[model samples]
Target chain A: MQKWADNRAWFLILPVFLVVAFSAIIPLMTVVNYSVQDILGPGMSVFVGSEWYKEVLHNPRLHDALFRQLTFSFCVLAIEIPLGVGVALTLPRKKGVWASTCLVLLALPLLIPWNVVGTIWVMFSRPDIGLAGVTLNEIFHFPYNYTADPLHSWLTVLVMDVWHWTPLIVLLGYAGLQAIPEAYYQAAKIDGASRFAVFRYIQLPKMRGVLLIALLLRFMDSFMIYTEPFVLTGGGPGNSTTFLSQFLTRLAVGQFDVGPAAAFSLIYFLIVLLFCFVFYTTIVNLGKGEAQ
Target chain B: MRMKKRTVALLCYLIFLLLPIYWLVNMSFKTTDEILSVFNLLPENFTWANYAMIFTDPSWYTGYINSMKYVALNTIISLTVALPAAYGFSRYNFLGDKHMFFWLLTNKMAPPAVFLLPFFNFYQTVGLFDTSIAVALAHCLFNVPLAVWILEGFMSGVPKEIDETAFIDGYSFPRFFTTIFIPLIRAGIGVTAFFCFMFSWVELLLARTLTAVNAKPIAATMTRTVSASGMDWGGLAAAGVLTMIPGAIVIWFVRNYMAKGFALGRV
Candidate 1:
């Protein structure tokens, strides 16, 4: 290992640090300042200690939204992780036309804008005019009205998320899968290990690092889901789809209640940070354990 | 026998994945009346009116151009800053490096909803409100971290021996970076740029918050249509289809590098 003692490298990083700070940190400080006080208008705020935090914490709307957000995140991870791994396992390993087709198909959903995913589905499930809804009612008679029915709305949103994001998990899982050594599989075959045993012992452990990354990324994104459901349901049929992000948006933008909204956002930030720290530390510890 | 079952299951998964996209294309061809009346697999009365409306209207088509301008600008800005920062992190052991790396990532975790109000004020104060630059700069907050993280991983994979030899042969740092380092990580850069473009292109909240009328994204425009009229289903579908085209083109170009970049960043 070699060290470059000169301090010139710091200058190389200065521009990035400054850009990110200007774009991210300064505005965050402003949010913090707003969170602690009541803002009547621009620069017209008076100090109030923790009053907003108390209001945000005690609000039943936040409580319900938090529960819904957690359930949605957990459900997305549960579905996407396993489905992604399964898809990765089935994909052809060698470079060819088939491999290229699969890659293109998988990447398609990831590129579309979030609101468009919702719009597509909203049009897609229209009972009178949409394809899915009309097909279901006509063929299977399933009575799928996602906008009016809460359970149907939740299911539709979940399906839309899975459609849009599962490809990302598959892409990550495939990368991890491709990196496994041929020797490990060859040795497992020589030992007459069953496919299940081979996957459980060799492939699963090898994919642990990438899987953790996939999990954290999916969790964070799903937890902060806003545009998709906002477009799909408008948090309608009595707030069934109003997740935490929507709740925060309703406060900050819709109602313009700056104080509690800012406080609620900080708490939201802390929860996401708490989850990331836990997962990151766990992965780091696993790496250390493997090294030892 | 087991292999046959696995093949069937995989085929089923593929169909599940592609069905909705197939449906969108199917609906885009049908007239509003035909769509309302039929529950058939194929369009009964095919028409191009939806697409025609999208292409002909300046208001509709302009949103796509505006979105592309900001997304492209943001991608270029993010990559340029991130490449050097990624190199510095990968190649050098600078002071406060760990802290700086973590700081970069923290920006990504903060929800945009939290910063919406403050950002509006910040942009207004700085006289950047309603400009494409406001959205582009705000996008950098998340995209830069992503680009840096992915690029660093790719740079780390390239052998340090190459750098040592290049420097020993009297190649300047800039010369080595351009001639040797960049070519090796071209695939990595492509993948990073793709993700940046994808995220920035889809992002609506900050784009909506920062810009009101002049630089409104296509996503924001879709929301506005609902209020303007009683949900112009045909126009919205046309706009939705148009939105998918840029992403489709992007994926086609970078399809091969997708898995590798993802694996490296492990994101």
Candidate 2:
């Protein structure tokens, strides 16, 4: 649909602009202010331009955390996207008790508080008494302990994330599926298209929009994940599960290195923006290429 | 055979989803000793003491009220502002519209942990500290942008011809929006509200930081279980179970609408 050129439309947007600006800009400015200064007390502060930024940039821990954050986010997207779409495809489409029940069950994980999610998973994976831990050790005869083993810790965090967030993708994909007009399916049937062909042609293309939103949302959220991993592993066994947010939280809140923490925060925010920009443009350009 | 395969796959996935939840529920029904002592599929000594403690205690129950209060407030604010903003983005080629949209999302990208101190100071300075509205407004940092993004996708699906027709028929913009346009996208609104409620309800860091006592959220209150003594696994699990109730109720009310909501919006 072609949109009209209308500057008057700003009237409609002014409210949101004000609300977001009021909430976002002030705190942002504070972060920026702290990023450049050395604060000792309430009124004792010294200007330290670029000093904190340089220290944060060279920090070895930040580098490891950033690397881990990228890997975790990549793994999350790779696993959750396909798995969520597959689960959504199998969901009962017809509205009834079964469909409603599936929808409600799918939604349960998302509503739990982040800390509670971590706690639940923590108990659920305990080697002594937890189901997953006991089953793996006793029944499956696997040497798995998230607390002591870094690989297990990584796997545990990854699995925890998938369990927590995959529902979001399923919900989005299911909504996209629900939107496909009945006529499309009817037309496909009339043409005698194979199930795979119909899925490849009709369903996948229609789901592109929702899937894009899901991709961006999941990427950003996973990249910034903090509370769950913090609670689950305490960045565990030796900072193995620590992501970017937890790293920054340790610097800012734990160590109270205000300037460096603020500087690192800005860099962290930029990295996310850069990735989102790349994704938004790449997918959008791909769509344009297909259109052309 | 194919239909059976699909059913099996779905059931398997659902079982995977429910197992942890089942464990939480299982723990909730047992004593702390029972939870810690043995691996039980079902509670050995079924007790409602965890639930009983929460109901009898003011601290635990008030957390639920506080969470609900802010979540509801945030959802209402997000929708009210986002409705008009989304219409503008969908219908018009406004200046810097694309950039503005992207900029809005960057707020969502900001790590909440980093912003905690700033949010604490900002809210405290304006004297909105420890109020439900503080958390509600703080939540809008993310929820408003999300609401706009979702609503824009839905609004773009409504053909321009409908708006044109409404205008030609002498309906005022506000009246057309309220009477015709809103009903058409009620499902979208339902989905958006659900997202907003979910995000606000589950968030702990910002919610915990912004409010100390009067408006402390249930998620924040759950931290009380971790104090000096050993972990209160039963009580914590019980609170976790209770936190899910409000969101589940909201989802039930919006289930039908949500089934159809994502149909229009490109989002």
Task: Give me the overall lDDT of model 1.
Answer: 0.85
Candidate 1 lDDT over B40-63, as tens digits, reads 678777888989988898888888
TM-score for the first chain in candidate 2 comes to 0.92
C-alpha lDDT values of all predictions: 0.85, 0.88
lDDT, candidate 2, B107-193, per-residue tens: 887778778878888999999999999999999999998889878877877899999999999999999999999999888888899
**Model 2: per-residue lDDT, tens digit, A12-46?**
99999999998899898999999999999998999
Candidate with top TM-score is: 1
Q: What's the interface RMS deviation of candidate 1?
A: 1.8
What would the per-residue lDDT of candidate 1 be over residues A15-63, giving only the tens digit for each residue?
Answer: 7888899998899898888889987876687999899999999999899
True contacts kept of each: 0.68, 0.72
Q: Give the DockQ (2 decimals) of all models.
A: 0.67, 0.68
Q: What are the C-alpha RMSDs, in order, of all predicted structures? A: 1.8, 2.2
